[model samples]
Target: MRRVTAIVPALLAALMLVVVPAVNARADLLGGKMTLRDENKMGHDFDQILRAQQNMVGDTYITDYVAEVVARVVTGKRPMPFHVKSAVIANPLINAFAIPGGYIYIFTGLIQSVDTESQLAGVIAHELAHVSQRHVVSRIEKQKKVTLLSTAGMLAGLLLGIAAGGGNAAQAGQALVIGSQGAATAAMLHYSQDDEREADHVGLNSLVAAGYNPEGMPQTFEIMLKNKWYDNSSSMPSYLSTHPGTAERITYLNDRIARMPKEFLERKDDNTRLKRVQALIRSRMSPANTALAYWDDMKQSDYTPMDWVGRGITLERLKRLDEAQTAFEKALSLAKDDPLVVREAGIFYFKSGQADRALGLLQKASIMNKDDAMALFYLARLQAEAKQYGEAARNMRKVNELVPEDWEVHHHLGMILGESGDVFGGNLHLAYAAVYSMRLDKAREYLKRANELAQTQEQKDQVRELEDAIQARAQIGK
Candidate 1:
């Protein structure tokens, strides 16, 4: 599937080596306390694994919003061992995890599950605190002689529905042991009681410092604790099990919240941004009919402009075109300036063959939200259909810049470049499209064709870069 960018979902095709890492990489590691440089390499390699294996949400709107929250928490804090970055996993398991490299993965399930932005920030702050304290590093250093399951393995065990063997590191089936353990990892690296308590303590301070309500921390904990039993999924237990003293944690958190100043505890969360992003995730990521029903069941009083957009998207997915059009129109009537509503509605009209309307709206939407890769994408395609290949290529290049690794974007860009008569550029992009899409044979073929077509040094350089990428990607068990 295309990455669910704004409205499109892109699958990373096992860029998710984060969970079960490569055996060779595992062997390369020294069994001692890791230096900051070693930790950096470990995080980089594992990040590739995570990206490669998991279906990531590439929507700039959703991801950027979360990253901002992470930034808010980490900013002005103690200097970290590594730079902090964030990614969204496409799973519906109400989970988050941070690897050694300050890499935090937030699950769509957790986003969907949160009641407010504060609650989400609360959870994120806790994860950040783990990195700040270097808990993972300390644990590993202290336990080198133990036969216990590695913290990562324990997390993988919980995340992948494997057994969490206390001392049985032997059950870690694969040498690379990382993939499905996202939540377990986020119990902040399978922490001890002291570590867990410290995370809560440090995280709450950061959460309030970031201008969020103190209660959000305990509320999220309450949600997680309850969810442990409500979710029947075998994989979810690993997420909850790692946080052994949830009741005590919640009690302490609530006690802490009670002691905080009333102003901090009672702060309001606008939730407008959160709601809009949630609407997108619900409508785009859920089953078509299910999503439609979810929107349909909402009371009229609770409906926002984005809720209508959600309804429209789900309706469109179900091929209920007339109703979807009405829903979109209703959303536009309510909030015409909302970029999400405008962009989604514009795409709907484009798909419905209302080219003139789509052209105006998408053109406006792209300008309104320049970071929206998908809007630029459809704009390019719409312009291409009008035989305005120049406009198409220009807009498509913007899309390419916004989503450099998206194969579909590259494919369309390649097509537009070809149509615009830039054969070398076109073929180079096609080679890239093939490389990202994991079609090695096609990648090699396009590289050869592009190499033959290269007439400039820059063109030759592009070919060489893509060739190198293909060679690396072709490595077995990577």
Candidate 2:
């Protein structure tokens, strides 16, 4: 994910090593892993595990942006997993990481730090490199035999800046005692100067291959270096330390850029697009900040359909409904052919309770882009709210099929099914919905099989209340 640039705990030192692993090592690391279907199952399972955490740390816009940017950059070359999921952890720190099975998180601070599209793209490419390579799963598997510092301990250290907090030495000691070189090994997880060089080389190659200017990487590093001047000052954020600057890293980047072809070296920045996107991001920032970014974009007339979309979105978020509507309409006018804009307009209509209009726009957007889950999801939601159970169920099912990691769809599906009088299916989905929503009572109802399936007592108890609720709801109907 493109990290939000801001102050953050320097946990990356302990986190850099546990990135994506090799594809071939995936199943083996998890032990008796199944096929792609099994991978999907694991993804679903893990998504549920993290769903609560996801909801608590809202502002998913960053996640959507990162995923879109990365996928856009690596379009044809790398096949993104069907259920690539992302969320922001609501931290003011500038850090981002990917968990096994495609769970990615970026902090808000990370978003605030970067100034350019390519710079953000560089971060995405780096994270994607981890995912495509399957680094995290490999580390998890490696840890099984060694029993490294407990996940809880590592998580605390990761979230709390163990190195800067003087916890690294202690964590390293723990790792050594357990014969677990995990956290200790993690601080040094950065590519051996060689691995670092390779990632830089591959990362640059990936950026250019993705059609972005490779210079974004060096430019990003340079921008980061600028943060050093602010170091230890009142305004300086903790992210600088977590990212850990090295003169060698910057020097290497400078040398690398110099070696590029002269034509490539002279490539122009996408100032227009960058400014527009930045404007939209700014609008989402505090009012004062939004005004600042808006003025910055005003100097550049190269706004695209996406810029309008971003502004529209920010307006909606700010609850300036009228202004937001105008922005969306303007966006639609500028890029009538752009399905994304149409979809946002449709959502605006849906949120405003103009169901018929929303459905029309959403259906049109869906026709324009067959695989757009947001359009389908909202359309399905409006249908369900209107009690068009069958159509709603069908669309919801499509949403679930396209993006099963989104548990909310299942919750909605379960409710629709229940309302439609399909008690059995409804009950099943209700269980899934509860599991995703972390609703204990509803979860238990669906947990008939889960009781046996659950390895932990907490999971067993989770299903107990759900079973009673399901039974009571069934009895009420009878």
lDDT at 167, model 1:
24
Worst 10 residues of 1 by lDDT: 6-15
lDDT of 2 by residue, 236-333 (tens): 44434534444576677678778877776555556544454344445544344454356346533666666666676666766777977877788888
Each model's lDDT comes to 0.71, 0.57
In candidate 2, position 11 carries an lDDT of: 40
lDDT of 1 by residue, 1-478 (tens): 2433221111111112232222213332346655677556656656554454346776778888888888877863556667898888766666776766688878787888889999999888887787778776665445333222354443344333222212233234322333333333223234578878998999999888878888888888888877777745512423454455878988999988888888997799988888888998888877677787787788957888888889988888889999999999999999899888899999899989999999989998999999988788889999999989999998988877866766777898888888889888888888887777567899899899999998888988888898888886665234
lDDT of 2 at 225: 64
> For every model shown, what is its TM-score relative to the native structure?
0.82, 0.64
lDDT score at residue 443, model 1, on the 0-100 scale:
88
Candidate 2 TM-score over all chains jointly: 0.64
Q: Please state the error at residue 114 of candidate 1 in Å.
A: 0.6
